[model samples]
Target chain A: MFLHLFIVNKSGGLIHHRSLSSKAPKLGTNEWLRIGSTFHSLYAIANEASPVKLPGNKKNGADDGIEEIQADGMTLNCFQTRTGLKFVITAEPNTTAAVDLGQILREIYMLYTDCCLKDPFYELEMPIRCELFTQGVENLIQKYSRIR
Target chain B: MSRTPVNILDRPLGGRGSRAETQVSLSAFSYLYSELVQYHQNRVDSISELERRLESSGYDVGLKILELITYRNREYKREIRLMNILHFVSTQVWKAVFGKPADSLERSVENTDEFMIIDYEPLTSTFCSVPADFGQLSADGYMSGIVAGVLDGAGFSARVTAHSVALEEGEANNNNTNTSSSSGGAQSGNNGSLLPPRKEKAVFLVKFSPEVLERDAAMDR
Candidate 1:
């Protein structure tokens, strides 16, 4: 089961946050902001701090870092766009076996572009308050979470 | 106004852009371009201002195309480095927009932040007939904005500008073979071999911002 989802903009500002289940931690806006910025800087530092230059994937950059982190109960998967937007999701530790979190993140991205970007009132990199976007993401998550 | 009855979201966005890939005639393009130039011409007092207006118009187009291509091809979103993005721009972006790859891509020896992509017959400049009073303005200024928009959207945040310079001797030969038309014979008189090559070349100069260079330097360290 998915626990939480966060959409962080390129500058590490928390643009959207949703707790998928009761098991998810309830983070205040300020706390989520702090986490988003912290993760942003940490992601950069982690990319630079790698002890070895990874044998690069031609499809991916050599500087990519911290894709998935597994804990005792939960697994956090991050899918980063070239523009540095982050879609990080926390789910059950074994969910990777049953679910493709990366694909879900990609779908969320498509939803974002479709709903948020196409909205003329929506500005770039701002907090996404679009009802359509919120509903679309919720629908997407609900569909995947229902699968088992 | 015949329309596909399906909802917008249900229909695929252009479907790899193949089915809609019918060619736009040169006359239609030039007419549209002339109208654009005339529209902007009425608003601006100076040449640079006119170019800036055109550039900004292309900026949104670049962003839209970037998002569309990224959505169509998944591997593109994984690109994180500078050079890889540039390669993608020179190949994929160029082909998507112009129907062919650029003539050549090169880095400036004088500046680490600057790179150049040369196009022999840029779609923007080849048939564009700017008036004499427009001074040294090139229609490729709009093309530069598209490049800037794509780079900025990709997190590179580079400034791109286009310039037309003298084409080299060997470059003349390369251009003819690459293009389907063997119109090179008409480019010059009987003394084409002895004289220098034609000067119809457009170079797009991309200057990376300091912040982006810092990130790149940090990556290398």
Candidate 2:
């Protein structure tokens, strides 16, 4: 029932992460930091590999927000309960269900934006610091942990 | 005297207590407005410059929104009554976008060629303080554009301009001392405060061209 979460940037590099279950194996701080930096570097490589450009001979200045790669995509996970707290997990090309994992990640993003991002206390581009996100995530992990 | 039937209270924000059809969150609105003001404030010089920038920005949004609002109005009913239409803009239209009605709407008594819609707090230019850098950006002009679009959509042809009529201490008379009674006559820039009161206020001058007056007179005859 435990799930891992990773936030990969547009370049498919991991930026943030957490485990869905308390009982799940813990990653060392150094390991997590290395994973984040490595993923970030890989993301840059992916972007360079697929440097998007406009069609019809349009030599645009920069890419127009749509880019993807096929060499194993990143996965973002989230555990949620009835009250909307979410436990998020993310990783690079490691989940059995990538599409389902993506759906969960999108939902978590929505929740985070609605609760934490909208909250005045949360700063932009900072780590998720809202009590609601934490509580939701913990509750979801606990619920799924018992079920699984 | 066959007076035009008054449909003033037919609007959503009319005195009869009709509710708004849609609800918008105040936090979202304030946050958006704050960002808009900030965006317009950056790279502007004088207060007039800041007002111009904000006015221009609001003008685009106003023009688009006016079209949508008028379309919605027509959907509910066919031809709109003139007074009712003015009231609609002053109340429902204003409240729908800015969360409040205009402060006042006064028709000129002498020439009868002008009307003024006043708002004590104009939201478009709220928090717009000109920065010390690059001099030229009038938030007021954007707001004026918005007013012009709305008025034109409502069939009133007028040149809308946002003016900052600040009152220097002891210069109140020197500011708005000469109030004219004639319609479309020279408007005194000293009608009220420029910087929104702790709350904001905007005055929209709705001046009709000579042709519109002639049409109104013909309709009367």
Candidate 3:
């Protein structure tokens, strides 16, 4: 599946964007807005989403809910890393296909960590504010998506 | 002159005078800079003025670093030519303080006395959002001041200006962090630094005033 992406810094300024794969069909303007709006909604919901656990965390003295978002389904998933930076992933429906998509998203995150995050220009939470991360991910997605 | 036999480690190059190699914590420097910004805030009457004031502070640090570097390397033979001195300052002196040479240094072809030092991510500018109420103060002035102070002390009278130059598209972004700010953001400030994915890199332009060249020429006679 091809996913067109836009990265912006926390200031909401667009930093980088491109299609991830050749096979993934480009979503139209209406589709793109729908995805963004859905993603934003999901992100807010995800913050409240968690696995089963006690209401209060005694160990760290902080409340952390026990819930995991399944990687499956035709939906948008956004994950923010420890540094208050956000990551968004979208995939087609179902857990089976979504599982691979999830893995792919994780790989993309790792790729971002390795390539863009390591670049001095990539400021944290500033959107996919790093140019190098954008290029590296694009190449990887293109090279691997076709082969896979 | 304290005249105490300085540790051998202090001497970078084998020279007659002693050179001290002082290790400063990045946290300490950041805190100092923060305080300096606060101090400048008192002197300024407006919000943007505060940032301009802070930039001048960075410039002051730059100048001090340049001076200390020159003092540190006084034992080295005098660089006869403008280029020679610039290289020595940019590479040797700059590296000593900032831990790497500037990202680039260039002489202005249009003007004989103008030189530029480019820092991809200037330390003062990074991690700092100039708050409103400080007036037209920017960190750029501080960085420029440092360069100016260093050049002036080195017998090269010139103006150094620090402008924000972000390279949004370039391969140099990946490999150049080591020369930039690996140890730069360890702040003593409240907002803890997220570990740097890579270090910051900077380029400095050094220009020699015509007076400096003329003096060197006269010395040759």
List the global CA lDDT of all models. Answer: 0.73, 0.50, 0.51
Model 3 segments more than 4 A misplaced: A2-19, A22-51, A54-77, A82-86, A92-147, B1-55, B70-84, B102-110, B115-145, B162-205
Which digits, one per residue and each the tens of the lDDT, describe model 1 over residues A39-116? Answer: 878877777776666675333342476788899999998889877789888999878888899898887776665455
lDDT of 3: 0.51
- Per-residue lDDT value at A127 in model 3: 40
i-RMSD values for every candidate model: 20.4, 13.9, 9.9
Model 1: pairs clashing at backbone N, Cα or C within 3 Å: none
Candidate with better lDDT, 1 vs 2:
1
**C-alpha displacement of B142 in model 3, angstroms?**
6.2
Question: What does candidate 3's lDDT look like per residue over A8-48, in tens digits?
Answer: 23333344445554645676645654554555454444445
Better of 1 and 2 by TM-score: 1
Q: In DockQ terms, which candidate is top?
A: 3
Where model 1 places Cα greater than 4 Å from the true spot, the runs are A1-148, B1-23, B177-198
What TM-score would each prediction reach against the true structure?
0.50, 0.39, 0.53
- Share of native C-alpha contacts between chains A and B (below 8 angstroms) recovered by candidate 2: 0.00
Ranking by DockQ: 3, 2, 1
Task: Give lDDT tens digits, candidate 3, residues B154-190.
Answer: 6677655555444554535543445334444333222
After TM-score superposition, the amount by which residue B88's alpha carbon in candidate 1 deviates from its true location, in angstroms, is 0.8
